[model samples]
Target: MLRTLTRFFVYVQTESNLKRLSLCSAARTGSAMTEPKLYRPPAEVRGMTSLDKDAFTQTITVPALRVPTGVLNKIVKSLKKSTIQRPGVPRVVQETEESSDSRLLLLDPNRVATPSSFSEAEAEALRSFGVAEELHRYELKLTYDNLKSEEVLEAVLPPGQDVTSAFSRVGHIAHMNLRDHQLPYKNLIGQVIMDKNPGVTCVVNKLNIIDSTYRNFKMEVLAGEENMVAKVKENGVTYEFDFSRVYWNPRLSTEHQRVVQLVKRGDTVFDVFAGVGPFAVPAARSGASVLANDLNPESHRWLQHNCKLNKVEGKVRTFNLDGRAFIQGPLKQELPGLLRGKASVHVVMNLPALALDFLDAFRGLLHQEPPCDHNLPTVHCYGFSKDDNPDTDVVKRASRSLGLPLEDRCSVHFVRNVAPNKDMLCVRFTLPKEVLFCSDEEHAEEPASKRQKCEDTTDSA
Candidate 1:
């Protein structure tokens, strides 16, 4: 008899009505609800072993309403907030074993564990529809198979433990930096992450820090395929690179776009340490003439490929050179001509670990003064500092590297915190004439070869 077009379901799940679990009445209007209920696994499902699906199964009784099938659709629409809204769980089920022509509309078990959750507005609406309501009891079984990944993890993870849900999605890979306490549950976490997220086939845990010459780190696969090549899109530009051989931080996408927006058509941009062209590709697409370089050959290859991939290969000139050499060689030669033109000139030093130290190479970079104050190239240099005052610290460091004071001349921008105390910052300033045009005394102190060895390089990023 419950075979009519609409199956009637009434769920009584809300904070205001949880106290009233009894037989339903036609006008059993619920109290005012303050908040919506989010689905959480029953407490009995905690401390799971190997994410056991059977362990999460539970039988629970919920308040229901028996309504005529003719008004089922209208009632379901009206009781939208009162129905079971789980991801994979259906809100409607068959009539009770009594086999009446009416359907038992089950309320959200988590909210209306008992009954009387419908609001005064709901009762008046039902009265207008001329549908009589009586709360019925229904036993429903919930299983782990239907729980969301967050709910599943929350239930199994120890109380007070740090959440491990945040991960960097690089193409199909979910890269996680697991803490010591979470290491034991890494596999379980990876499995759940891959299971819940579509198009994510692999999960990896970083084993070491990203301080290599190439800025890449070693990682152990926790789940899924071993594929390392990743295709990613940032700032509307596509890039494909070998994730293990190069450094790619999804967190820096906003920072990259921030600097690129300053470039206009006919402008010139030098991207030293440009890993896979995150800055260069988009800047070139913006009609700027770009010179992109990276010391890592893999980064260079991918930079060229990404330029072509984004159809900007013709606009970008790719180089495989050290950060300092790119500044001293191609950039030095190209700047003189571009600086004379009216278009803007910009240099992007993005290797946050070493870019600050490389600023010394810009000293005496151009043998002549810029044609005009406005024509001087602006440098966007990145650095990492753990000092309590990072803005002043970065400006001082850049000034030290350039052999001049920049405290009053340069503007420091806080980028992102790389770790607990370490912060990444970008210092922006126009190249000073004093540094670009070196005095005889300053020029004879040392050669580039000798100076490169004595600088403050690091146990850092």
Candidate 2:
């Protein structure tokens, strides 16, 4: 029993020495006791003496002085002007029954040249306050854990290279376009962004535009789960779409709202090339009757789904047809009846890629001899242009397609800049009366040059 008790005491002393040496190791490295140990484990019974030489350069805590509560505030204020108070660490207070008279003052002994010998001025000040030679020792906590994503990336990214500050957020996915230099650190940058931003569960980088026919782009998952179904809220309406299958641009929110605001209750809207009814559903909700059409089966399905989702199915008539067929069929039949009631009719052609050429479909559309009124359908044609004067460019293309001068009759609105030199423009004009009432002779007399030009535009788009 005596031998067991002696062995236990020795073990306890060995454990205590091990803890002391461990703490001293941490202090030398300027690291906190609670910080993660990234280095390999020290050899058994040898403490942290086997740590790499690089570990010694790591930040560690310095010993501090505990001053009386009465002098704590004054000493802290004076220490701020002097070199005694450590940089970056806040002055901490130890709460106790004597809290009002005592507090802790952390100091960086590493800043002094002769760390073993105290400064004359510092020792004199401490001696005046009855301070002892013993100092409070503990690991210093760093503010590194609270850094922002950009700050964390700055430390890891190579010098002279900039990080992308802008990223598109679709539901839980963050879409970024990183340069070639940034690809190497893409995973680390993505993880840091996910950690700093709440509600983002995934990060994806756009590789390139792969499917031009369907407006689909190829993207690779940089971090997190690979769920592409995104729920986006635009212009007060919620839209759920398979981001991988359908085309949804959050940048068009302003344009969608602008056109929807123009239509009053009881107005009739015809949306050609409408992908998922970003305009149609909103117009229907505003009490306007909408005829929404899309060629893509998936987009058509989602458009119908959204109409039901927004509870506007009753007001919207959906169709899956080519833009020209939709214009020459449903719109042709619906216009006369709608015009008889003297209701405002709007034709929305939003496929900027080919909508300008589709304007030729309006030629010889209606054969009605005399519509007792002059309420012609107002067509909103969207197109893309790379000209310096995009407004004039769109108007000229629109006029050439219709074979009529639209300079005086039309109004052009600049939609947006798709790229540095390319822009999207909306040309608003009334469908020409002659084309609406296409007599056989006048239809035959259509300019051959104008018809060929329209065909050329379609082929290019």
Candidate 3:
């Protein structure tokens, strides 16, 4: 019993030494105790009347070592990872006077508060370099210019509130949808955004939800120049337009490219609600004949401009007409010719808010004569749903608008989250033959009744 107790005490002492060495090892890497914050904004700063850069100026103390210039290289090599690692903070303080033969090496105060904080390996290296065993104090003056946007915002906002300074960049414009609470600091947020992001000349925040009619939301310029024309590049294609007058969502660049990829050479594409020709121009560039149309005159004007800008104007035929008219007129005329041809046809309706409703225009679309070509046009329709089962909800709406059920026939793809409980989705499928070539009799009956008849007709004849 006496021997076992003695062994236990010896083991405890060994464990304690191991822990001290482990802590010393962590200190050498500048990750020891809680770091003293460098960003110190003025107290009682809440909502700023204006961004006061001078108010956030402060000074901080960090542990550093005064080393001789003769052995500076050796000392720095020995310190290795022990040097301070803050951005904009220099590791070595250059000697101001040419006569001075020594410089101060900045050390992370959190890790090297005492002389014994160095690990055994680092300590032996320092001693071999003939360096002093003591750490000196260095005053680091910090200001709003020194602090990062996130760090600055955190100090200004009330504790516990999330910092939402992130914005989507569209050319020289920074577009944001500021929350109600964040509106009070909108100017400060905008200024910080412009300061941090390079090449951003203007900042704007959406005032309300996107307008359903024109699809462009009202926005107020928060900071910088109030230029609304934005030039943005996506998927190697550059487009320029008035951001305030036309609808452009940079987030949908991936979705735009995804649809454009499907249009192979010799194929044809019809962009029913083409806003600035994101789809039409790219598809045209890929050697596919494109017919692009938009009801918004501003969107139509820019669609033509973008097509020319991308040098695909000749490839894409532009039309300024309502979606239904574009469909019943140009699309109806083109579908017959495309049906008889060998190339694949694609119809893109990307107006997410009310695109599904426009699916009805395809019903009895080919009224003159139903062509025999089975290479039906593929429809890529986008919609927004707040339902738990967004996929099902989108498909149902698409089917309802088309007067045909598409639950099993169509493929639903999750696009992105527009808001809480709201999702933007894309439903893709070949336009059903029955819906496309619905006769007078077929149109008289309920769409559900025709689903069975259409299936039976395929089986019978």
Candidate 4:
């Protein structure tokens, strides 16, 4: 049966299906109405053949079953229902003297007549219809397996150059960080990404992080629609935010879950540099009351929106304030109540850029209080380190920020690597009574030169 099916392909290959094809002006520009040639069909088929690159216009030879000419219309109908029938490719019929009672029914090749491609149900259907092993013999071409993202991109992009494969998908938008040389083909690359991936409707390129204060970056629409609002679901909670306005790193999802896992029911969380509440909302959903604050007003707005969206508004108090102010104001106000309780208290500072500098804000944060033995907020402060010993370097910076040694007081955890040399580190430490309650007057003043040097090294987020 398979051999007969294979032979049919060769028989159909010699015949023309130009009547089924949409004849272009160039194909029909002749005094005589000559049949149009197949759009770049294979000159010869020996073994398996790959489809033409121009899949839309390319034509392929489909095997036709030899049956009574009277039932040809019914056979066509059944084939159309079972396979992809291209209307542009015309059908052909042939008769031989020995097979005078039988006629060949040529159907659309692209539809479903390939020998190597058929479902079990299709095989059963063919057998039920008495499609025996005695039909014309020809080899059927198999369909090529789908290409990888990089492979598809390489074919579409310029040869010999490496295509950028790094992209962050925020909801339906694929965000790519293309370099300077790749800028000219940004639109083409974006379109290719959207095409190769499913469920992605938009593509954008990060131009630069222009407004550092808000963490809002400049982005150009490379492909798809010009919509910036993204709806992302992480840790089983949905977050809606403007991708162009707020800073939302889908990459930090693991980190968000890690921190939230530490927070249990009845615990209180203070998110100082919460951007769009990736940390705050999940922690709140985990049964912790959260006090989330961000320096960006847009982030503050979306944080509140997301809190309500998740129905965790009652558990979360949103604030738009600088990291220092958030520590000195709402956090300071809530610290007393948090300490008097039995529940755990977590302070999350995720802004790795300048969060180390904001550590000084924790010094003299709470005023006129004696050392409490009951509850001290465990600070989870993140910072980027580009040193030989990242752990030690992060601890040293945390110590300098707190105005106290953290070698014994803190535990440093490696978060992730941001770049070749830069590493993101999280220093988890119990807020020291000395630093948290130290009087402003007694706080040690650093030398002008020393403070300048500290500021220079800790400015990046």
Best by lDDT: 3
lDDT digits (tens) for residues 64-109 of candidate 2: 6678877666666555533334234466647456567676776555
**Candidate 3 Cα misplacement greater than 4 A, ranges:** 1-35, 65-87, 95-102, 108-134, 371-373, 444-461
Residue 32 Cα positional deviation in candidate 3, in Å, after optimal superposition: 5.8
Candidate 2: regions farther than 4 A off: 1-145, 210-212, 368-373, 440-461
- Tens-digit lDDT string for candidate 1 (312-425): 989999999877789889998887777668998899998776677788887777656443455888999998876767788888888888889998898988776555455678
Instruction: Give the alpha carbon lDDT tens digit for every residue of 104-219 in model 3.
Output: 99886666767788889889987888888787777788777777676667667767777634466789998876667788888888898788777999989887666655677778
The number of clashing residue pairs in each candidate reads 10, 8, 0, 11
Better of 1 and 2 by TM-score: 1
Model 1, C-alpha of 353: deviation from truth (Å): 2.2
Candidate 2 lDDT for residue 336: 81
Worst 10 residues of 3 by lDDT: 452-461
TM-score: model 2 vs. ground truth: 0.67
- Model 4 earns a TM-score of 0.68
User: Each candidate's TM vs. the true structure?
Assistant: 0.82, 0.67, 0.82, 0.68
Candidate 4 lDDT over 338-387, as tens digits, reads 88899999999987766777788877777666657678899999987767
Predict model 3's lDDT versus the native.
0.77
The C-alpha stretches of model 1 lying farther than 4 A from their native spots are 1-51, 96-102, 113-116, 131-133, 158-160, 368-374, 443-461
Error of 2 at 396 (Å): 1.1
